[model samples]
Target: MHAFVHEGNELIYKNLNDPVIEKGKVIIALRAAGLNHRDLNIPSRRGENSIPLVLGSDGAGVIEQVGEGVKELTIGDEVIINPGLGWEKNSDAPPKGFEILGMPDNGTFAEKIVIDAKQVEKKPDHLNWDEAGVLALPALTGYRTLFTKAQVKKGDTIFIPGAGSGVATYLIQFAKAAGAKVIVTSRSKEKLGKAKEIGADLAIDTHEDWESLLRNETIDIVIDSVGRATFNRSLSVLKKGGKMITFGSTTDDEITINIRQFFYGQYQLFGSTMGSTEEFKEMLDFISKHQIKPVVDHVFPLNNTQAAFDYLRAGKQFGKVAISINR
Candidate 1:
């Protein structure tokens, strides 16, 4: 098997002995691996330690073998790897971090990888492997953030910042499906055009005073994945009693907000992260039923992962950048 290993802050593909599946686990022959900003940001624990640690989290593949005690999936079944394995499923369970497939351990950016059978789902027959690989994370996050955390409803006007990112692209489509009027903002004009193409009701230039442009309007929900750079503006554009749902901090993590402004507006601010397994399933089903597809900016061979990282680092992509493997 060939895998990209993190050998001291760099990614290198090298030969490895075949992975042995444990009881209740399944081994997948990966076809396409999705590359995300987090994939590029995973650091070696110690400066002297290896880097590029099998370097991907999201992937789609066909089952090669199932370990003893595995029953739900079998050989030759097409599936997508679910990266978030052990967050709480029960409402009563407290939020505790669980080991993810790629960052702290082996990931899917290889010829094959093994994981618990529950971590894999049957991929939609309508989508090819490359599309399924990138759709899970972004679509699940967007679906959960808007539908559950924010409780967005029909006719709601939701504003999303950093409209060109993978999550935002999916969010716009999902929001429209829910009958919400969608407003998007991005610094890049090209990305804004792309957003409109993908069904955003309106695209606002981040460079201009969008606040003034939106002064008289009241948005029902504001999804601010861009963080600090647009946090205050997100706060400014919300309707009284409306909610603000923020997920990622692509720009900067820290931001200062006026407590008085929140009180005066009676605003509700919520933070979301990657969703649970159930949410992932719901997102997959929604995509399947609605014929929604993720926007893939580009695809690179597994060996050219560095080029993929360079592309994402430039922050000019309209959506996701994927690395094809095992195909």
Candidate 2:
């Protein structure tokens, strides 16, 4: 088997021994894999003596082998891999021993990967391999953030900054499907236009004065992932008593807020990350019901995964970037 691995401060495409099937797990011959910003950070996180690890979180593939004690799944089932591990049900936060895929465990970057059968869900019929492959991690994050945390409802006005990310795109689609009025911001005019095409009611340039431009708009919820760079501006546009949910801090994490103003507004703020298994199932059902397909920005062959990482790092994508493995 071949995989893109992080070894001694660099990523290399190389051959690796095939993963052995374990009890309660299944080996999937991956057809496609999705690229996330975290994939670019893994190499830096590893120490000089760290072992080589496969690099991917989102994947879609066919079941090639089923291990003992796994009864619900069978060979040849097309499935999407859930990257979240150990948190089984909906909760305020992930439980202890929780972790994401693609790090300690071998992930979906290779032609074959062995994962717990519970982590595999049937791929929605409406999605192709690429769409299904890129759908799990980001979609789950968006679902938990918008519906579970914010409790967004019909007619609510939602503001999303940094509209070009995979999670942001899913947030736009999910909010719109639930009858919310969606607004997005991006420094790039091209990304703003794409957001409008995908159901955002308004797309604004990030450089603009957000408070002045949205003075009349009642932003019921602000879903922020860009963090320090856009946090204050996003909060300024929200109506009193509104909600603000954050899942990622792409720019910088630390930010100082006005404690008095925050308390005076009676605003609700929540932090979220990758969702639980129940939420992942609910998200699949939701997208299936809405017939929503993931927005795939580009597809690269498995061996060219380094290039895919480069594309994502340069902030050149408007949606999820994918890697074609067996396909």
Candidate 3:
């Protein structure tokens, strides 16, 4: 079997033995995989090891084999693999320090890989392999923030800073489905136009005098992934006692805060990561029922993953980047 391994600072395509299926695990014939920024940041365990770690986080494929005690799934079943499988255990009673998949363990970038049966779920018929491959991580992250952390509701006005990334893209669609008015911001007029095409009610240029453009205005919720670059703006736009959800720090993480904004303003700020499997399932069903689809920027072969990584690193994407692993 051939897999992409991370060697120190680079990834190499090399031959490796097929991973044996363990009890309660399943072997998936990966049809496709999706790349996220995390895949590029994991430090190699061995400084100069030749066998680079697998570099994919999300994928979907057919089941080739199932391990003992795995009754819910069988060989030949098509499934979407959820990378954040431990969220159930973590949410019930989290450990002192919990780590996500694709970091210490092997990941989904290979032709074949084995994982616990709990890590996968049947792929929704509404989604193609490429769509299923990219759905799990970003949808789960968005679901947790919108429903669990921020508790977004109908008639709520949610402001999202940056409308092109995966999380923000999902937030825009999901917020609209929930009957909330979504206001999006992007630096590019063309990107903001795309945001409107995708259902954003109002799209503003972050570089413009947005504060003045929205003078004396406030929103019920603000979801910001561009941390340092837009944190102050997010704080300034929220109505008194409103909430803001912070997820990835795509922009620089550090920012100066006015402590008075927290006290006198009575605002709530919540940080979120990936959500539980229940939330993942809920999102899948929501997409199926609502016909909400993720905006896929492009699809590449598994062999060309570096290009996808480069695209994401360059930050020019308006949606998720998927790697087709099946054919």
Candidate 4:
């Protein structure tokens, strides 16, 4: 079997023996895999990861075989992995043993992979292979942020910062489908326009006076994935008692919050991570019901994963960057 392996902090293609299916695990013949910002951190794992680590978190494929005690699944099942290992339901935070795929475990950047039977879910009928492969991570993150954490409702005003990334793209569409008024910010005018074309009610240029433009409106919820760069300004855009959910810190992780304003306004601040299996299913069902197709910026072959990671790191992609493993 061939896989993209992390060696000396560099992601390179390698051919290794096929992984054996352990008891209570299943083997998947990957059709497609998707890239995330986490994949960019691979180079930093110099001493942490052992030799030849397979690095990928999201994917969809078909089951080639099932391990012991797996009564529900069978060979030839088309599915997308939950990726999240421990957490199975919605909660205030991930469970004690929570782990995402690709870091500690071998991931989907391979021709074949193995996982616990509990990690797989039947692929949504409405989505194709590439779409299903990318849907689990960003969609789960967006769904948990909007529906579980923020509790977004119809007619609510939702604001998302850094509009061009994979999670932001999914957030824009998900909030819109739920009948929320979506506002996105991007430094690129063209990216802002693309966001608007995809159902964002308002797109603000981050280079300009975006706060001034939103001076009259009170945001119901603000989802900030940009971290330090937007956290302070995001608070200013929210209404009194509004909610703000922070996921990734793509920018600087450390931030200063105005203690007086935060307490006086009764604002709610929360943190979220990749969602549980239950939330993943709910997200999948909602997407299937709404007929929402996740935006794919480009599809690279498995051998071109380095270029895919480069594209993601350069912040050029408007949506998910996927790899066609079977191709």
Candidate 5:
């Protein structure tokens, strides 16, 4: 099988051995795969050999072979890899030993991959290969961050900082679908317009003082992924006692906050990551029920993966960048 291998600060397409099926695993003939910001960080660890090794965590494919005890799925079934491995159910947090796909284990960058049968869910018929391939990781992250962690409610004024990411884009869609007034921030005016096109109630340019633009309006909920660059301002916009959900820190993770304001104002803070299998199922149902489709900014053929990686690393894409594995 052909795979994009991350070695020495570069991605190389090479012929790698096919994944051997395990007792509870199934071989998937990958049709499509997707990129995340995490992939961008992996290349930086090249000299240290700390890269996820294969570098990918999102994919949609067709089952080509099934292993023992995998009675729920069969060959020829179209499915999406959940990526979040070893965490089966919802809890206060993911249990110890949890891992995501695409590192240590070969991920979807190849034409084939072997994954736990339990982690594969039926792909929605409404989404095409590219859409399905990019759906799982970001959508799950967004869903758990907004609905489970933040507990967003109808008619709530929800503010999401950083509007162009796959997760941030999905947050806007989910919040609006749940009847919340969705506001988003981005430095790119074009991205801000795209956010409004997709249902954001208000879009603000972060290049200016967002507090002034918003008139210091208290937001009911704040879903943030950008860390040090916007964390303080994100908190400042939230209504006192409002919920704030954070999943990623693309900028500096180290942070400082006014302890007195936090205690006296009574803010609810929650940190989230990849979600449970149960939540993945619920996310699928919600998206299908609402007929929501993810925003795919670009799709590149598997062999042209370098260009895709470069595009994502440059932060030029407004939505998910997908790799077309088979077609």
Candidate 6:
């Protein structure tokens, strides 16, 4: 099998031994894989002694070989891999053993992968191979953020900063489907326009004064991923006691906030990551119910995996960037 691997500070396309099926697992003939910001961080986290690792998180494929004890799935079934591992049911937090796919575990960047059957779900019928490939990670993150953590409800106004991400696009679609009013912010004018076309009721330029433009509106929830760069500004627009859910910190991890102001405002802040298996199922169902399709900005062939990573790192994508494997 050919895979995109990270070894000693470099990413290379190379051949690897095909994964063998294990009990309760299935070998998937990967059709497509998705790129995420996490994929960019994997190479930096590797130590000098670290083994070469396949890097990818989201993927859609067909079950080619189902191992012993796996009964619910069979060969030829089309499915998407749930990147989240260890955490099974819905809970306040993932278990201590929780880890995402890729990194320490070889992931879906290859033509084939073996994953626990429990991690594979039927690909939503409404989605194509590209859409299904990119759907799992971001959609699950957005679902848990909007529905579980923030408990967003109908008629509520939801504010999303960094609107160009895959998760942000999902948040917009999910929030709108739930009957909430959606507002998004993006530095790119083109992204702001795309956000509105998808379902955002309002799109604001990140360069403008956010608090000033939103003074008349009441934000019940703020879904943010920009981290230190936009954290304070995101809070400034939220109504008192509004919920703020964060899944990633693309800008910077460290940020100092005024404790007094935070407490005084009575805001609710929550941290979220890739969701559990149960939430993954719910996310799939939600998208299926709404007939929602993921926004795929570009697709690259398997051999061009490095270029896909470069495109994502440049922040040029409006939504998800996918790798076509079996295609």
> How well does each candidate superpose onto the true structure, as a TM-score?
0.96, 0.99, 0.95, 0.97, 0.96, 0.98
Kindly give the stretch of ten consecutive residues in candidate 6 with the minimal lDDT sum.
43-52
On residues 79-196, what C-alpha lDDT tens digit does candidate 4 reach at each position? 9999899998778889899988998788999999999999999999888999988888899999998899999999999988899988988899899899999999999988999999
User: Who is ahead in lDDT, 2 or 4?
Assistant: 2
lDDT of each: 0.84, 0.94, 0.83, 0.89, 0.89, 0.93
- Residue pairs clashing in model 5 are none
Position 221, candidate 5: lDDT: 93
- Model 6 over residues 269-319: C-alpha lDDT tens digits? 999988889999999889999999999999999999999998999998999
In model 6, the runs with Cα more than 4 Å from the true position are none
lDDT, candidate 3, equals 0.83
* Candidate 4 regions with alpha-carbon error over 4 angstroms: 46-50
Give one digit per residue, the lDDT tens place, for model 1 in 1-327. Answer: 988777775567788778898999999999998888777777534344644467788899999999999888989999998888686472322266665568777887899998889889999888887888887777777888988798888998989988899999999999888888999998899999999999998899998787798886779999998889999988887888989988899878999989997898899988887888877888888888888888999999887877888899998899888889876
Quote the positional error of residue 291 for candidate 1 in Å: 1.2
* Candidate 5 structure lDDT: 0.89
Superior by lDDT: candidate 2 or candidate 3:
2
Segments of candidate 5 deviating more than 4 angstroms: 46-52
Model 6 root-mean-square deviation:
0.9
Worst 10 residues of 2 by lDDT: 42-51
Cα lDDT tens digits for candidate 5, 92-116: 7999999888766677888999888
Off by over 4 Å in 2: none
Alpha-carbon shift of residue 206 in model 3 (angstroms): 1.4
